[model samples]
Target chain A: MNQILVVDDDRELRTTLVEVLEQEGLQAVMARSADDALERLQQETFDLILLDLVMPGTDGMTAIPLIRRQAPRTRIIVMTAYASVQNAVQSLQQGADDYIVKPFKIDGLMLTVRLNLQKARFCEETEAADLDKIFNGLANGLRRQTLQLLSRQGQMRFMDLVRALEIEDHTKVNFHLKTLREAGFIDQTSDKFYQLTTNGQRAATCLSYICKSLEASAQARPPIVP
Target chain B: MNQILVVDDDRELRTTLVEVLEQEGLQAVMARSADDALERLQQETFDLILLDLVMPGTDGMTAIPLIRRQAPRTRIIVMTAYASVQNAVQSLQQGADDYIVKPFKIDGLMLTVRLNLQKARFCEETEAADLDKIFNGLANGLRRQTLQLLSRQGQMRFMDLVRALEIEDHTKVNFHLKTLREAGFIDQTSDKFYQLTTNGQRAATCLSYICKSLEASAQARPPIVP
Candidate 1:
């Protein structure tokens, strides 16, 4: 069963969401605060998180990063009563997969939850096959151009990247390498040589890739100052 | 005739480009320096520019901003004999619509020139309709998230954006806004409302907006203590 984590300070709502998720044919765990959520996330693997944005002591917005760090691959959805567009857009930027307005209907909420989870699964499979380029889409468009360079060249050398892509000193490239390696999306055979971690080179769905390209580019950073 | 300006220190290639454009039944003007190009740009309107990247002064990389400042609508393409992928990418980041390696086949070069000019036309038209959103797309994903809040709400109103987007304070928003405005992609109204300028919103074709957005976020200074 796909594992779901429900994080809310509301005891009653947490219980209700858990019961509902269990009936939906998945394993669900509840955390009462962001700290608790982090604790649970460290020990458990979750496919999705149903988070409350306004929770007391480590709210969804603040805790989402913790959740992300703990389970870097998990999908998170923020559920909150204060449903401004800013909240919706910001939470998504903060790594929440989707947001639900408070006082939502069970049918719509369930549908949203199910669809998000399904998308997450599809994305995971897609990422493993494509090397997380798809996940980069959900996160925001980053690394696609570098991937484009790698795809075209078969591989990128250290000096070429430093000279061509960024004006920063080479020290910055080292930082980017560490980040890419830590993320587990890229593999470095040695210093100064890098490729698309296998999955990045695969040619796949054009539309999804294009859409994700927009997002990935949007989310990308220059690996490191180098 | 579609008028073009050629800016290069190489006397022979500059003359050849002008000859080719004229033979193609388009008007092309030649300049041996970036200063000459800037002066011509200020005095006369041109449809496009053929810029060299490695002249003694005001190279294509440095000249791009000056050209744009002088004639915001003029399309430009950077030319270089030496192909440095990093230089090409940096030129794109700096706002040249397209580039050509030295010893370009006139046919291929003309095709790209045509395509970029057409694209520029289409972009100009699009920007007239919605620049704020378009410019936001040019920024890195994190900054874009904050910019989206500013764009969607029409007025940032400070508190809502901070809480809704989960940002800490007023300074961060302004910092991103300053970059947006400085790039000439955005403008703040008399009442201090930030909006995207026409070119700022629609000028991005090579996905530089993602980098712009990320840079601001990564460079975001911490909130000041009162």
Candidate 2:
């Protein structure tokens, strides 16, 4: 038996999905609000989660990472009526397994749901294989250094940032910072002060420790799992 | 050598793409107008065609079947800024090999082109696999038929349509239509007129045809591909 959590503010849409998923022999849980959805996540695990983007508060974007933490094994599929390439790409970047546009076929929807599930069946095996690999260590080295410095210093000024890094060009440093900000790893204040946000700090603290300790193991990694 | 034709009214994008694809070692060709593209098609056989949906004169939807019939071996990939599941599914049904949402990563664009090319590579070894087999078959069933009929007819009155199809209840058909319209397949003018437009027709036609043929083929040894 599979459990699917559907979180959408639209009562009719949410309820309809519950009925549909139920017909498919999956225990479909409906959450009319993101807060309620998060509460459900804390209580039990789901096989898959269907999240709606336009919600009142703690919208899909904010909820994604938390859901990733709570139900690390569950595949998350984001649904949005206001579909854009930027949004789709961003959702995929945020670790969503797949996305379904609002106006979709019963067949296309079912196909995506089925494909996600089938893909999930073998995901962990491949994920484990990739998690055992190296190569990206050198690629992410500068970003890690930025994170580490931020964690140790609490906050860093824009001008001081450029001087400390080996890179001389301010433009290159700014590019890296922009990438970090976009990826939700760091934040910049109005004063041009760069610091980790609550979520960013938490992730950084945990990830930094893991990477630091696993530096040698990182070097010995094999080919990644696609 | 695989000849890749890029069709777009935008000179800048077309120029950039030709440079990019040629740099990647592909036999790239560009057409500013549908007429020009047809002319190019006559002079040479391309392995792939990249089309822009919103264009002056004949757009992607209008050009699809023409290209499909003219060069059955050629794969078409549609590009659009507006990314909808409806369009994605429709383009697939229209014998389009794939789609790339606009303002996309150059990498994503290249990867999709390469991936489709790679898949078509096997089509040479296997003679029977037509675009219909690879794109749309019986994946959606009645829903595809509903979309196709609506697309081809341009518009139909709801009550009259239900009677024509001999559906028992009006609400069920209406609900399904709402979903289809939302998916961008069908558009209703005022309360009475429903039209198929380009996006709607593409997805509806081929999918509907493939499904009916499959059903018809079930009793036979196998469905013959033509």
| Candidate 2 lDDT tens digits, B1-226 | 7789999999999999999999888879899977678778776878788999888988787787567645555778889887776566556545565678898889999888876675455444332222222122212334444654454344688876777667799897787777666666678788767776444543443332222212211232322211
Error of 2 at B95 (Å): 2.6
Error of 1 at B194 (Å): 45
Error of 2 at B2 (Å): 1.1
Model 1 captures what fraction of native contacts? 0.00
**Cα deviation in Å at residue B73, candidate 2?**
2.6
Fnat values, candidates in order:
0.00, 0.02
Clashing pairs in 2: A133-A222, A134-A221, B154-B195, B155-B194
**Per-model i-RMS:** 19.7, 23.6
lDDT of 2 by residue, A113-145 (tens): 765555444443333332212112112546656
Which portions of model 1 show Cα errors greater than 4 Å? Answer: A132-226, B1-226
What's the C-alpha lDDT at position B52 in model 2?
A: 92
